[model samples]
Target chain A: MSNKARVPAVDGWFTMDDEPKLLASRGVETGSYFFPKNLAFSRNPAAPTEALEECTLSRRGRVWSWTTNHYKPPAPYISTDEFVPYTVVAVELVDEQMVVLGPLATSCDPSELSIGAEVELVLGRLYEDEDNEYVVWQWKVVQ
Target chain B: MAVEGRSVSDVVVLGVGMHPWGKWGRNFVEYGVAAAHAALADANVDWRDVQLVCGADTMRNGYPGYVAGATFAQALGWQGAEVSSSYAACASGATALNAARAQILAGLCDVALVVGADTTPKGFLAPNAGDRPDDPDWLRFRLLGASNPTYWGMYARRRMEMFGATPADFARVKVKNARHGVSNPNARYRKLVTEAEVAASPMVSDPLRLLEICATSDGGAALIISSLEYAKAHGVTNPVRIAALSTVTPSYPNTLIDMPNFSTDSSFGVAAPERGFRDSIAHAAYEKSGIGPQDLDLAEVYDLSTALELDWYENIGLCKEGEAEQLLNSGETTIGGRIPVNPSGGLGSFGEAVPAQAIAQVCEIAWHLRGEAGDRQVEGAKVGLTVNQGLFGHGSCVILKK
Candidate 1:
């Protein structure tokens, strides 16, 4: 694992260093949060022109909903040579009261999931190339 | 309740028509032109007399397809008619309908023709072409491998956990819709399906079987709309008039996770609206039309999945939250039920033609209102409604009365 170079599928979404967290933007005045952070504009009607501040999201949340895919999705989604079904979880951030969606940890089983179950963020590989591993933030059941 | 301080003029649906839903493997233009001609004939109006044309655009066919209004006009032998095109995912037809109604209400056009058609590709739909990472539509699939059904599955599972809805309940929706489809001549799947058959079908997404989800197909639908005064002048008395049309967007701090968005807007700063986006859509229509859910004789809704049909019942105010399953189990939503829904078999039987299905829903309502629906007619139908939601958080509702 140490020999393989790691990178995010999309840059600036999360960090890989110690105490990793999902990166996001929050309204400085309105106290609202945005994921895949809106760099161009703020959507708050109360303060339409307020400046946005970058912040890392809460590390833990609860499962709002969950489902598993039995069929491979069509492109531009990358997949493996030997296809395997995967699960997606919609997690509600405890602090923000917002729902963020992501794939569950690859090793997690769908049968174990239930609504309101505690979950935490962890970086996992989505796919890989010859030299580097493509990764994205995923949700895992808190043990 | 007529949308306080706004005096809105009424618009009438002069005629409605459709090209049968199927996998015809033909040009979408052929379907659009054929449906337009049928609508014109149904209204007893000449094509040359139309003052405006509005088309629900399709994205699959490239440039000419995106410019659907002009393409359809040229194919129908153009007469210099004014044209407009609208694209709103599944709600495209309603968007086109709203556009035409706007023109008529504004006195810009006395008569307008609206058409929507599509020859959809088989299998799951892909995002629009290009390598723009910023597009959430692309990012969802690219990073999480989240297909459309994946989202539906999440909703189904959540409902099941919250409401004690079983898989059998979901299968029952297919059984009911398929039965309705058998009576619909224009339906793609005309054979009735059993609950056992639905359960046996392979799972595409957990909790949603292949038979329980709608398929994509090629189809077309068109409507001829005019001012209420024009209908009267044409000697058509008691024509079906459009009572209200609501096209609303999600309010700020939208809590529900909708399509094309990776995360929902945070409610931390402000309180979320009491009603979700779907409820607001129906509320707006009811407010504008001065009609309530009790007044509706029947309805047609977007049923992308069997579970979704149940969701619509609650969203459209046909029932209270978490009671849609009870409404279904009571046989209250069947064709002969107290408030019949999807008598045209819905997307379950007709499959999705994207741009065309919403118009087809209105077409079904028109036929029922005129007492022309042969086998699937609702007896003494006086008021009908259609509800549809498109990607990017567009919700549309239309109410029609005879």
Candidate 2:
């Protein structure tokens, strides 16, 4: 893992740093926030015609809901040849009031999660190639 | 936007047909052609008599599937019938049905044929092939690894927390639907399931076992719709009439965590609608039909997951919110009970053929209303409703009356 270059599976989704946060876009007129950045258009009815501004989302949130996947999803979802079950948590962002879904940190267990539990964002490897590690944002319950 | 009041002209279902729901390993066209012939025969009309044809688009079979209306017409030996195709994920059949209704109401056609057929892939459905990072469907799978069951599990977990619902409640939905399936001749899974069996099944997602969720299957269903005047002219009376067709999109700031979405729309700027998307779907149907839940003799809901079926109970106003399990326990949702749901076994037994499932729901309603659903029949069935919500915020409801 040491020699592999770490890269986001998709660019412009989130940042990789000490305090990671999801990249988002906010409608300038309507004040509506969008995840994965609404690069094309705004869905706001009041201010349907407006430009979106780039922004960083809240780094911490509460668990709105959680689940564990016991089956491997078909592609284009990348996974190891020997698949392992993983947990996913829908985190309700404190500031945005929007529930964002993502896989839990590799260390987290599904049995330990509860609704309203606090969690923070962290970048984790989704899958790795010989030369690169594809990373995506994951949620970890705050200890 | 509010839907206009009731339609001016009423559309009637002259006949319905299906190719059954299962993994047949056959071409979709064959299934569609078979269903079309069956429906035409059931309607007692020749292919040459159909003035319009509407087909539900399927994603798997390339251009022919996309241009389903013409594909089916060609297979059935077209005689210059006007054609239209619609695609709305799982609601494709309803879209096709509504398109036919619109044509009949507009005096464009007196007799119309609506067909939906799909040959689904064996496993979990994947996004369309591409490396396009922008597609949300692709992005969700690539970034979060969130399968369809993962979303269902989240909703189930949330319901358990908010409503004090237990896993057993979810299991009971399967048990009930499975029991109903035992009597449905066209259902894929005809064996009855028990709560113990459901609980023992391997977990697909937390709070959702393998038995609690529906699988993909290959199937076809078709309907023959005609104007009430046309039906009367053709010496048919008291046919099952389409009282209302509600096809609605969610209001802005859709709060539900729907499929293929990474996050809920932020409710920060605009206030969310009073009713959730599913509730609004049923509400629109109620408004258009001028009928309340109390008037429904039976209902056929999209039970993609057993837990989701419970959600539909409340969404369709069978009972108040957080009281679906109570209704289920009271036996009101069973075949003999009041407001019996999924008497034809629903997606729990039928599995999902995507395009065909919604049409199949209407077909089941037609059978029960005509008192022709041998064994699975609901006694004295008059008014029936079918509700289905599709990916990307498409919701459909069809109200039928004998």
Candidate 3:
């Protein structure tokens, strides 16, 4: 097997630019990405002060929908004995009508994913498959 | 039982009709036209009298980018009353219903017709065309082999573990709905499904068998609704009016519904999520109509699978959480029972018709409230509800009255 670390079949799903990153528009946007090889990582592009702005969107949406996953994904995804459930949210960006779906922080729950709740995009770990760790994106409650 | 407080001047369902739901092997547009004509005839109005047309779209229905309204109107003879199309997964039909009602209520049009139709492929619903790797629905199927039933299976297992519901309880819902569907002339499965037959059926997903799951089929449903004043002036008295239309999104348990996606949010790390997101659709309706769940003589919920029907029971507030199985076992959810759910045989008997299913739910409620349903009538039934949740978290719950 080639020893070069891979993005794990995910780089094919998104419409990435130099950074090989998409704003999570299509296919699936919930998987977390391990950094260091964004193909084009630009820190503090627009909002220099924001912790998440350089990584993803700037305070993208008022939550469109949300959910807490108390169950782990099957093998090849999560090896934890029923890994701790996470939250998945579909946030409609403030600038666009786009709805981005992803996992919420491990601490999030159902009460946080209401119709008109406020949500912000942040970089987080989704899960891992085999050898190389699998990193992905996520949403967190602004409060 | 009186719950939601509804507007007395709400729009009335002037007409409702449906093409038989089954494997008809016809294009979706053909069914749309047929159902539209049937609705016009039932409403005692000509098709030319329709002022606005709204459509719920099927993904394969030839919309370059999913434009449903114009596609359906052109098929039905473009007399051009304002037209639009909407998509909300399974909630498309209910979304269409609400759009038509809004236009009439907003005085944009006095008479409006809403239609939803589909000629679905057999077996699992395949995702959008080809190699595009970003769709969650598509990724789930291609990667994890999580077909639709897999989602249903996870939910079924969760319900069993969390609510103490048994597989047999899920089967009872199918048995009850099939018994009711037998009376519906348009229902695909007219024969009753026995509990034993369901148990004997081959498993599609664990805890759910082939019989326990609903099939995909072709169907068309239409509704002609008008301002309450317009109905009265047209000499159409006692029309079944739409008192409330609630299209809500997945909330609490919505947290646990992760597939082809990574782990669910850790509720153990934080406070539990709210149980109100899904349940509030009907509750919101009750608040608008002043009618309680007990006041609803009948209900038509999206039973994509038998286990899902149990979920709708709690969501629609028909029974307390975990009590759905008890309610089904006691026949409280059967026809002639206290609150007959899916009296038109529901999707269990109807199969998955995509766009048309939610509208069909309202159509059935209208027939029951009007006493026009000869065999499947809910005696003294005055209030009824229709509930469904579509793709991308689009949910709906509508309340109607005679």
Best by DockQ: 1
lDDT for each residue of candidate 1 in B14-78, tens digit (9 for 90 to 100) = 98889999999899998898899999999888999998899999999887689999999999888
Candidate 2: which stretches are off by over 4 Å?
B1-8
Arrange candidates, best TM-score first: 2, 1, 3
A1-143 in candidate 1: lDDT tens per residue?
55678888898899887556889998889989999877667888998898998888998999999888888898898888877989999999978989999999977787778899998899888988898898899998988
Q: Mind giving the per-residue lDDT tens digits that candidate 2 earns over B293-328?
A: 999999999888988999999999999999999999
Better of 1 and 3 by lDDT: 1
Residue B273, model 1: lDDT of: 91
User: Which docking band does candidate 1 fall into?
Assistant: high
TM-score of 3: 0.75
The CAPRI quality class of candidate 3 comes to: incorrect
For candidate 3, write residues B1-402 as lDDT tens digits: 112233336689999999999999988888888899899999887777788888998996566217777877887787757887888878898888888887777776788889989988766776766665566666554333445565676577667767888988888888888888897889999998888999998766666777877788899999999887788888998889888888776443234443334323312122344554567667777888888887788888878888889888988888878988888888888887888888888878989888888988888888888888989889888888888777566768889987
C-alpha lDDT (0 to 100) for residue A134 of candidate 3: 44
Worst 10 residues of 2 chain B by lDDT: B1-10
Q: What DockQ does candidate 2 have relative to the true complex?
A: 0.85
Task: List lDDT for all candidates, in order.
Answer: 0.90, 0.90, 0.70
Per-model TM-score versus the true fold: 0.97, 0.98, 0.75
- As for candidate 1, its clashing pairs are none
DockQ order of candidates, best first?
Answer: 1, 2, 3
For candidate 3, state the interface root-mean-square deviation in angstroms to 1 decimal. 12.4
